[model samples]
Target: MSLAERLVRLPDPRRRRGVRHPFVAVLLIAASAVAAGARSYAAIGQWARSAPQQTLARLGARLLTSLNVRIAPSGSTIRRIVSTVCPGGLADLMGEAPTGAPAVAVDGKSARGSRTDTALAAHLLSAVTATGRVVSQLRVPDKTNEISTFTALLAPFDLTGTVVTADALHTQREHAKWLVEVKKAHYLLVVKCNQPNLHAAVRALPWQEVTARRYDRGRGHGRRETRSVRTLTVTGLGLDFPHVVQAVKILRHRTNVKSGKVTRQIVYAITDMTAREASPQFIGRIARSQWGIEAVHHVRDTTFAEDASQIRTGYGPENMATLRNLAINRLREHGHTSIAAGLREMSYEPFTRPLDLLGVAP
Candidate 1:
């Protein structure tokens, strides 16, 4: 029923002998420390060591040291265990969306700190729900890009009736066909130069004559922006896009309140849903939800300082990223608006709060 119970179900990747700390306890402790704002192995170990005996007991951390006292795993041990644990299994356990037609926004991010002069940074593709929950995440291979990894990122979920949104990079006909035919899901994919014919066709539509339209205006972060969306039934458009039933064009006009500078851009997209299935208003909301993945990535970079971390060794980067996602989701679920503030509160004395969040057992 608790997170630790679910975590204990994962197979330990370590050897059978000479293990002091229970593998489940080590994993639970690491995840709890990360949720409490420990950004690195050293910080995680420090948090474990500084935890009160009651908190450690709740986390199932009863490993005894030479001094004949129960203790947490050392920094090196925590690092090794995390690095070797199965990332996909961990993600599958931590990432689960609520039932219904959830809006899934897929996006990719590169960890700047993991890059070297000779090698590119670790690129990860993530599927995030509209409510800012991570549904899944997978690392793109060193030899490939997001487009190549997009389908795999989506393969784990049973996406029936779900709306999966992605940027222009994943607007290929193959992706559309796969989503519609194989997954039985709908797609709201951005059209751009990547799909030249599809882009031109959607752009050339008589959007002004479309019967369905929606407009919205908002001010935030020192800028005022207006968005106008036009939707047209694609049945008569004579476009060759796969399973396309509607085409959309969104025009955004922005003005910087501080600089008085103005800019405008138009975005095109094709969706499997008909004009009736996805009204103009619903389209507008779903389009905005496409940025949810960006919000998740932004928090990891800014709040957790993920881009500044120097952890690049063996599964370390991906493993750390998984824990960071879990932490962010937990904080948001617990009604913490600001991740940094949540970390500070959890990091205060008597560290039992983190254990409580982790559903640790007494």
Candidate 2:
């Protein structure tokens, strides 16, 4: 379905009285404005005002029959709609993860600008696909952490046949069992010091004796890094962890091409899939998928200016983040790797090219 039609699914938080714009129109304008590089409500309002009458009409802008004039929703109205809309619904409507079998990465990010003296910044746990599309996100309530909100963040989607990848924070025995047994999905969870027994057991594996099963090198941004992955089957072993089929150890070495500095780090991960089901290289690749969400976080901050946004009223922060995700995901899907450049192309003089991305029929 078109994003405009999908937006109608968002719960209307406004009452019927004094509603100046169509619900879909208001949201469509907000989304279009953001896609055309509007960062905040003020920018959205300005973009709406400068928009052509026909553009507004196609975006569902209301027509004043008395004067035959089409006017955009006011900034305050847009702010109200954005701040009250359901974030989860918005994320899904903005091109969510495909249900078949893509690898999904779970991570959390904090909107630093939302922090106040009385309350901490809003931290959201997000599930992002391998291609950097944010499929699901939920706020971690004040005084709570992602670990507690993990299940709730993933509750909305059908994840069967999905390989869920996450850091050590989500390595709980119950979570693993739920993903494997209940959700009918697989988990590739990193092992860390937080889970002492699992961490020690993974560390004690005869990794030195097992040759590295996978090798890789990365060169970019003034540094070169090499990595190797070694896998060992531990299903028959008397491990305390749930449904452990393979234990993986990844060792990474980084050398600063400019400074001649070298650094090394190692990480271990456990997956429910047996070696036959998932090769050692596949395990390493899926484990690396966690960076997709990290890249999303970076793009939000650097490209979309998410960390700098001061929107903290109601659901404003999360809603704006979802809009940013929409912009980036749409551009990426259309083969625009440079989000900033794609947004520049979107902000054309006619202000109509970005509408094509929204599936607006000419």
Candidate 3:
């Protein structure tokens, strides 16, 4: 079925008199606006007002049948509907991969300046895939730790057969134990200053004392460098927390060309998976892929102009963010060579035609 159809199938939370079915019209409007570069409500409203009839017809329904343009609802209405639904429901709609360990990365982003009265930002926790698909998201109450948000965000999904990765902020003992003991999923989390004992042990270990390999090279007006990392499973680190199967120290080196410059970067990671369960190379790759959240954030903020959005109040901000994610995932699923290019193409034409976007026949 089409994305529009699937979206329409989502349960509606409105009980007001003017409430309409969860028609694809609004979703189509939102998607087209996103594609055409309408990042804010006013811009989308303007786009909808410009060609009301055409847009409505494309959605297979008409909100404002008269004058070919109907009055669009206030942005507040949109936001309210978005916030009512559970984000996990939307995640399930994105589907899943058939094979291989599903790489799931959890990270948080702050919508700075989203609130008017105070400087308090909206902290959003998102679960995304390696290819930058946002599976789900949650809005944490201000003053709460990400650990509190992490468990709730993970509750709805099946972590089995999945490899969950997160940064040091989410590397709590309980978090690791929950993912393994409760969810039966493997976890790859970074160990940083926050975990004092774990951090000190990872640091105090005879790291350089262990045999390691270093690789380096040079390029245009600059030099290049690489370090082949290896790790030996060590026990008795005296960690106060539980479920820490092993600790790993990753050594990295870099060189500059224009000027003969040398730099070294070292990282430490902790995981419940042991050497018998996971190899050093596997750990390295998982740790590296944790940055997928960065790429996802970059695309949402830069390509989609999420940070520049002026949406505030009610559900507008959250709903719009979800729409951007939906648009991104759809474009990626279709094998679009470039998300920016795909969005641009969708903006100039009709959006109700899901088959066209999916490169399928009607």
| Top candidate, metric lDDT | 2
Tens-place lDDT per residue, model 3, 25-90, is 555565556656677766666665664554445554444446554445444544456556544555
Q: In every candidate, how many clashes are there?
A: 0, 0, 8
TM per candidate: 0.95, 0.97, 0.82
Model 2 error, position 219 (Å): 1.5
Q: Cα lDDT of all candidates, in order?
A: 0.85, 0.86, 0.67
**Per-residue lDDT for 257 in model 1?**
100
Error of 2 at 282 (Å): 0.8
Total residue pair clashes for candidate 1: 0
Q: Which stretches of candidate 3 lie over 4 Å from their true place?
A: 20-24, 50-55, 63-101, 209-228, 236-240, 254-263, 348-355, 358-362
lDDT of 3: 0.67
lDDT of 1 by residue, 243-360 (tens): 9999989999999999999999999988999877898888889998896678788899988999999888777888899999988888888898788888788878437777766666
